[model samples]
Each structure stands twice: as structure tokens, then as C-alpha cells.
Target chain A: MRSVLCYGYGNPGRQDDGLGVALVEQLETWAMAEKIPGLTFDSNYQLNAEDALAIAGHDLVIFADATGEGADAFAFRRLVPHATIAFSTHAMAPESVLALCAELYGKQPPTWLLTIRGSAWEPNGALPAAAQANLAAAVVFLKEWLRRPPAAV
Target chain B: MNPEAEKVFNAGAARANAAYAGQRRNVTINPITRLEGHGKIDIFLDGKGDVERAYLQVPELRGFEVFSLGRPAEDMPQITSRICGVCPTAHHMAATKALDSLYQVEPTSAGKKIRELVYNAFTLEDHALHVFVLGGPDFIVGPEAPPELRNIVGVIGKVGLEAGKKVISMRRRVREITSYFGGKVVHPVLGLPGGVSKALKAEDLPKFKELATAGVEFAEWTLGVFKSIVLGNPEYVKMITSDAYTHKTCYMGTVDANNNVNFYDGVTRVVDCNGKEVCKFTAKQYRDFIAEHTEPWSYMKFTFLKDRGWNGFAEGPESSIYSVGPLARLNAADGMATPKAQAAYEEFYNTLGGKPVHHTLANHWARVIEMIYAAERIEQLVNDPEITSPDVRRIPTALPTEGMGIVEAPRGTLFHHYQTDVNGLITMANMVVATGNNAARIAMSIDRAAKGLIKGGHVTEGLLNKVEMAFRAYDPCLGCATHTLPGHMPLRARIYNQSREIVQELVQD
Candidate 1:
């Protein structure tokens, strides 16, 4: 079985921005109930340089995050190692993490980005209905997507 | 916005427009990336195209105090940690300390040791991130390097792949120590009122000791790297001590009883421009020493010394504005508590000319020295017999009222204050984050760099990178500095002519 790592990142305290983390919670539960093997989960408020190590050890990696701009409910796309200048130490783009992994560890696990369209982002606010719908749709899609062969994904 | 704020905004805009009446130009660097959250830089030029004024504006996260209202005071450690994705541990520890103060109880020796251990581990890893990944590129790859070549990958390219692996390996090992005690490295669940939730297990002691040893070694290696890469370069050293980055201002940081820098706990100490001790105050007495100044154009509130008073954004001893963070911590203290760190600290001051190093770029060096202190401190704490003792909690019994906590966060001094009712529910909350404390000084640095580098309408990417380096040295984390609704802002630069017409606009998304 191919090892799969699902990492969700965003500030959960910020309303709809929590979709990625919330989705991971549901996915973990679903995966466990289905007794799916070779699947691992992790999350944080944001991604950092250390995540490069975590991703390198996995056969496949999926990064889920909330997006303010996107027309679809969710967008799943392949990721390639690309280094971008980040202005803050607080977070790093997933692509940057991949780039670091390739640079330091000489490993580039096939990676994908799952962006769930989110509207509300108020701190300590509840997730809006629209965001909830988008998250549900993304979760459904990811469930099927995860079941596919590693190469197909 | 309130009437006063609106008035200030109008007045600022009017002043800028009037200054631009003689064919001046405006350069706006919107949404600075990387450190934490969003920040922007606005530069106005005179008729001759020399920089007239430059302002750094950051967005503030709203309603955090209101959000904490009526919540249990004990929840602050968790709730406040969630305020920012970065530096959650700093907020966690500060809030946890506040809870201890609120309940009028102190943690058992073991509990305190455990807290310090985790905290030091955190500082080591966090500083490593800045040195090797975030701010390191400015020096490691050279500031004049192309934008694409000034990142972690570029640092690895310059420093070699093995050194890159060492940094990654060291961070992972250090953070493992954090995860062992804190439960999660990002959002820790370790701190409790008057104690930590878990005691260090005997079996975990050996592993922790090993990590601590590695941490110290890693820090020393990093210092060597910095010396060879930054200090060895004459141009870099000159730039570090240049007039553009230098500021003679008061400094603030946490210090031990002996006046040595302490990250987890200490009394707040302030030093004047000439490195003279200004005052020392407890966390509760912070208000008597510090005050915030608001500007209409930015959400960040600039902090200043209350005794000296607010003197605009000007530096020097006359101005009330003071800086915090690594360099400030070193300046405010007598020396590092750890032996190796003390040596590194001495070398830092000696190489930089003397005490109270005013150059902003020197912050990077001070940060490396701090990593040594943090690592050695970690080694000391882990070896203490009480580190694994089970007597952790000293159960709080005092009635809830008011409390305050302070810590030297990686960026600078962090303060957490809370007022609670008899029910131990929060009635009010206030946090003076590190970035907020340095905001005014950061503004001054940006302004000075713009004036010094942007001469006669000539602005190169290299010049802009150097300008950004001024603030980046402080390792500002605006995400933690200001509480705002969540969203990403696009990076853009807009240039306007004397007529206020947009001559050119560049956007990065």
C-alpha cells in the first residue's frame, strides 16, 4: 500500500478558514471507520519549514487549505517543487515546503493541493453555510480521490 | 473609524499631497510577505525625488479582547495561542503565566523546570528557522541576489546541502522535545494554572538530554556559520553598522535578577540609548512604563516609554520610542546567563564596537547568540533532578481578580494582562505583542532606509531588498502583533506622480 499523508493548515479560530482543518477531522474519522490503511493525518494553523521533513517521508502528500479566491467548491491540483519568497516565518507555501524537501532531503513525494473555497474569515466567528457546503463537497471528492491508485492521483 | 482616527488620516493624506505638490512621487509597497500576516510600506518623495516620508502600516485583528470577555480565564492559554498560527507557544506561555498570577499560586519547582525546558526548546527551534530559512537569505545568499535566489533553497545552495540537512534535522529534533511536553508543537496543551499538565517521565529524560546536547551543538555551529557568512563579509558588516540601519533608542527586554537575558521569565528591564539602565518593572507595573501611540494610516499601535513620552517616530534618546526583540534583549541585559552564550554575546558587542548596538541588522547576530543561550539553558534544565519530579501542581486557591504575565518572545517582549470576576471568567484582556512594541522602531528603520537608499528617483530591486532587510532583522510577526479577520492580501506596488495619478502599478498574487 502506498503511504498517504493528508495535511490541513489554517487558523481554525477564523471562521471559514478552518475548513481545511475541519475537513481533515471528518476525513480522519471516515478513513478510520472504513479501516483504510496507509493513510496518515496532521494539521496546524499554518505550514512551516519543518513540514518538509514530514512530507518527504510519505509516498504521497495532500495539502488542504481554505482559499478566498476560487469559483468552484474545491480545486485539486498537482504540485511541483517551486520556491517562492515568503515575507514571514509564520508560514510557508506548500510549494516552498516541497522545494525545501527536494533541496535538503533529496525527496519529492508526489504532492497535491486541495483548496476549499471559503468566504467568511472573521475571527471567532462560526462557519457560514456556503463554506460548510463547500467543505462537504470537497470532503466527498477527496474521499473518492484518495481511493484511486497512487499513479492515477 | 472614530472621529480622531479619521482626522488623523485626513491630516496625513493632506500632508503627503502637499509635499507632492512640486512634482513629487509616491511609492507604495503593499502587503509585505513572509514574517507573519500583512504589512505595507508607503514612501513619499520630495520634488528632487529624495525620500520625504515612509510609513509601515499593518492590519490589526479586531475584537480579540471582546472575544475573550466572559470566557474562563484558564482558557486563555489555549484561546490566545490560536490567535496566531505563528508564535503560538509564546502566547500560550504568557497566558499560562497570567493564570498563575490570577490565582495567586506558583508552580512546583518541577513544573517550572518543565515549562522552562519546553520554552527554551521552542526558542532554539524558532530562532533556527529565522537564521536558516526566513531572514538568513538576506545575508547567507547576499541581499543583492535576485529575489528568486533569496530563500531557503538559495540558502542551501550557498551553504551546501549538508548544512541545510543539519538545520532541518536540528529543528525536527528540537521540536520533538516541544511535542513531548506540550502535546502539540503548534498549539500546545501543556501549560496549566500553577503547573504543567504532564510531568516529565523518567524514561523520556535520556531522550530529552540527548536532544538538549544536540541543540547546544547546533546553536554553536549556527553561530560559526553566521560568523563566517555575515561577520566575515566586510560589506555586510559595514551595512549592518551603517547610518541607515542605526537607531539610538531605548531598549526593552526581560531579564533575570542578575540582569541577564531570560526568555521564559524575568522582570522587564529598559536601557537608554547610551546603554544606561533606565528602569526595571514587574509585569503588573508595565502600564506605568509603557504607552501606545496610534497613527491613522495603520492598524498597528506604536509603543513608547510613558516616562519619556511619545515623540513621533524619531529615534535617539530624546524620543520615547523603544525597541524590543533579540538585539534589544541583549542591550537591556548585562550578559547571557549561559557560559557559551556569554562568550558569543561578548564577541557580538566587541565586533559591533560596543554596548547598546544601535544597528538594526545586528539583531540577526544577537538572535544567533540567543539561540546558544536557549540551547544551553535547555541542557541545564533537562539535567536538573527536579525535571522529572511528579510534584508539578501547587493548586491555586486565591480568588480571581487581576493578573499579568510577560515573556521575551522570539521577536521581542510579550505581555498578557487579564481582569477576571469572582467566577474566574475574563472581564477584560489586553496583549502587548512583540511586533507592536517594535512597530515604531520598524517604521523608523523603513523610513531611514528609504531616505538613504532611494536617491534621485532611482529604486532597484536590490535597494528595496535592503530596505526590507531593515525590518526583517527584527523578525517581525505581524500576525501575532495584530488580531484581524483572516484573509490574504495581494502584494502590490503603486507609483503615483505629482498629480496623484497612478504612473505605474505592479501586483503580485
Candidate 2:
């Protein structure tokens, strides 16, 4: 069985900041109904060091998050392990978790980061209309991508 | 929406959440600035550009009391734990203990052990994060480093990438252990009213034993790192022992039956600055001894000993100011129960001039020692013969009423109190979080450090870093209100109904 791990991270309470979480929730529904084998899903406010172990034994890992820096639509990019590790009281970057996988597990899976563009960050806020459109577009793309064969990686 | 809701929160996040809304992002709020949607640290300046007073305006999260009304009392362990992302386990354990009191049932021996095992694992994780993530930059990366360099990344750069890998890996191992027992590390769900739902099977004990053993070695290495970086350097030690970061307030924590520092359960012990025991009280008597003074500006109330009266934020015997957490636990106890931790504790006091060390920066040292104890305790727990016993819970059959539970959170002493109806429905729920307890000191620390560092309206990144370090030493955990809606309300009425009662509610400017 080819194991794939989809991990989404963001502060869902902040408007549009929950884009990553929203995406994963949609994927979970699709995966469950379709009975997509060898797929596991997890979500949190931010990626932490332990998530390295969470993804350690899996063959492929995809980290999903909402970004204030990217374009309004969405950007999906492959990620490589970095040699540095920096932590905080706030949150950890996706790349840092990937790096830990390499350092601690003596193995690194092929990984990608799906960054949904977020336009707002109000506390107890809702995802804005435009961001919701972006989320819908991204979800469509992700659904197609997941159905594709593993050779695409 | 509750009137208090309009006064503070938007509650949009709570509303947006549907089935499997996934993990919440709004749990880690600090003190909020009412209706403003964000917290601010206001520094009032005098004519000469000298600091008058600095107040960290912690906005109150409104309607939680009202939000939680009419819920089954048993749901509190799960609900209250959702308040913070960082220390959910602390809140969960406190609520569970309160449940025990409310139901008037004692957990089976195995059940209490399971809870402590998981609780100690979380303490280990929390302290490691603080030492390496929050406190590391100031000491490891150098105090005078640039703004960009004053972070865990910079600390890793100086401490060697190998150490970074070990730190990350070690933290993961401990968290995994916490999850194995508590069901999840960030927001645990295993805690129940009488006892835990799961037991430590003999088969899985080996994995936990391996990790707990690693935890001990990790502490030894971390102490060595601290010794070389902070204590070994005279300048660092001087700064740690400096007057600007010192507070001569009283200390409080829970101690075991032997009077050693016990994080899981103990009586509340309060000690003066001179290392003299002031008073020891049970969780029920917390009211007679402690009082919270609320300021219009902060959502959090400043806690002090009632006998001293609310003397404002001044730090002295006459003033009611007090501190908690690792330093407080150490000061309030006779010693640590574990041998290695006791040795470290004694060395810490001796190095800092013996008993009730006043230097706040030494909290980092005290915290490390506590982590050592937690790690050792985890090992001891894994070896217990009854650790695998199936009798993990004592089915509660007692009447419901009022109950209180206290625990030593990695940050400080955390208090959770609840009052329920005869049918076990909650009527009242109140918490004076570790951060709430330290609110006055947090403000005072900023004030004192600002007076020393920020001169004549001039402030550099380094100077501000120093001031930031003062709060960092406390390792303060603020209520992180990140959600658009109040998601903590598993069952809601007050945050909504209270707002309905308030026909005219205005957002404070």
C-alpha cells in the first residue's frame, strides 16, 4: 500500500487563515466516500516537531496551510529538507518539520506544500468571499491531483 | 450572541465550525484589548520621556461563563481543556480533578498514576519548548544579537545543528509519549471525572520506558547547555542576578505529602521572599487566602494574598504580589522527591544565594530542574507493577456540588473551580490561569525593565529584547483569542443569552 499523509495547519479562527484547515476538511469527505486507500489526514493550528514523526513512516507527505504572503489564488510547490531548525512559542514552518524528518528518522519522504492565499485575519473571523472562491478552486485541483497515479510525484 | 460577546469577541469562528471542523486555531489567546480584537502593551511616558507605568492590556474573553452554562458537568474536562493550545493537558487535569471532587470519588491508584504519567510528559515537552524556543534566543544567541537573530533559528545556528536536531527529536519523543497516554498531546481527551478511560498496557510500557529514559538524558544535556551558555558566562549570570529582572514577591505552588515539589497533586504552599513559609492551604481554602484585583484595562485580574490587601502592583511583603511556576514550586517546597532533581534544586538555590531566589531570570534554571524531575518521575511510573492494572477508574456515585482543583502548570499555578446543579449540570465555571496569576508581575516586569533599559525615549532592539526577556522568563501564556467565534462553547447559553440581556452594549474605546 502506498501511504500518503495530508497535514493541514493554520489558525482556523482568523478570517481566511483557516484556508489550510478548510481544504483538509473537504479532502477528508472526499477520501472517506471514495475509500481512497493508504491516505491519512491530520490538522492543527501549526506544524510542530512531533509532526516529523507523524510523517516519518509515510511514503509521501503534503503540508497544506494558508499564507498571507502569497497571491490571492493559491500556490502548490514541492519542498526539500533544510539544514536549520528554528522553533518558537507561536508556530513552526512546514520546511522545519520536513527537516526534522530527515534528521531524526534518517529518512525523508517526497513532500509538497499547498499554500492557499488568505486575504483577511480577523479574530473569530470568517473566511472572506474571495478566499472561499480560492479555496474552492484549490480543492478542485487537489481532488484531481489525489486521484492521479503516484508516478506524478 | 451574549452582550459580553459584543463587548469582546466576534464569535465568528465558533459559528463557522461544522462537523469535523478539524483542530481549532483560536485557543491560544493572550489577554485581549476589549472590542479592539487585539492585545496591546501600553507604556505611559512622563514629560522627561521616562516611563511612568506600563500596562499589558489583556482583553477579557467574555461570555465563557455564560457560554458554558447548562452543560453536563462531565463535559468540562473536554471543554475547559480547549481554552489554550499550549497547555490543554493542564486544564484537562484540573477539570478532571474538580470532577473527582464534584462527584466526590477518588481515582483508583492506577488511574491517578496514568494521569500523572501523562501530565509529567507534558511538563517535559513544555519546558523543553520554553528553554529552546522562547528562552534560548536571549541566552544562546546572545542578548545583544540583532532583532532577526533573536529567535530559535539563531539559537540553533550558535548551538550547532546537531543540538538543534536533538532538541527537535527529543521534543517529538516526549510529545508522542504524552499522546500515547492522553490520546493527543496538544488537546488531551482521556481525563474523566473519576479516573482515566485507558490503562498502560504492559506491552506498550517498553516504548514509553525507552522515551522516558531518553527524557532524563535529554535534561542532563540541556542542563549542560544552560551551564555553558548562561551560567558559565559571567555576564549572563550577572544579568540573571541583576536588579532590573528581580522581584521580591511571595511564591506559591502545590507540594506532595512529603513536602517535595509535586506537580500532579499537593497542598498549596506559599513562601515569602526570605524563604519563610507563609501559609499552606488546600484547594478549597484558596478563597480565604487569594484574591484577584481587576483593572479596567486588563481582561485578567491581578492575584495576590488577601491578607496583604490589594496594594496595586508593588512587589514587597506589604503588597500582595506573588509569583508561581518552577521558581515558585522550588521555593515553596522542601525539595524535589527525585534524587537527580533534588541535587539540581539544591545547586540552583546555593548558586543563587540559597532559598527563595528572587532573581526572576533564575526561573529558567528552576524550570530545567523541574523538567528533570518530570522525566525521572515518568521513568518511575513506567516501572510500577500496577501501571497496567485495568482498574483505571472508580465509577463516581456521589452528589454534585462545588469543587476546586489546582495543579502546577509549566507556566505557574493554575486554578479551576466549578459549581454544578444536582443533576450534574454546570451553573458556574471559573479559572485563574497561570498567566492571570502573573499578570501583575508581567506588568511590573515590563515597568522595571523599561525604567532600566529604555532611556530618554530611546529604545534599541537589544534594550527591548531585554524587556522582552523579562516576560519570557515568566514564560507567560496569554489567552490566544485567534478564532472569529467562540469555539470553546461546546454547549452555549451565556455568551449568547447574556448579550441578549444587554440591550445597549457598546464597544469600549
10 residues in a row with least lDDT, candidate 1 chain B: B481-490
Model 2 achieves a DockQ score of: 0.17
What's model 1's interface RMSD, roughly to a tenth of an angstrom?
A: 4.7
TM-score of each: 0.93, 0.82
In model 2, state the lDDT of residue B84: 56
**Candidate of highest DockQ:** 1
The 0-to-1 C-alpha lDDT of every candidate, in the order given, reads 0.83, 0.74
**Residues B122-216, model 1: lDDT tens digits:** 89998999998878999999999988998889999999999988898898888887788787544578999989999999987898889889899
State the weakest 10-residue window (summed lDDT) of model 2 chain B.
B489-498
lDDT of 2 at B340: 95
Candidates' interface RMSDs, in order? 4.7, 9.7
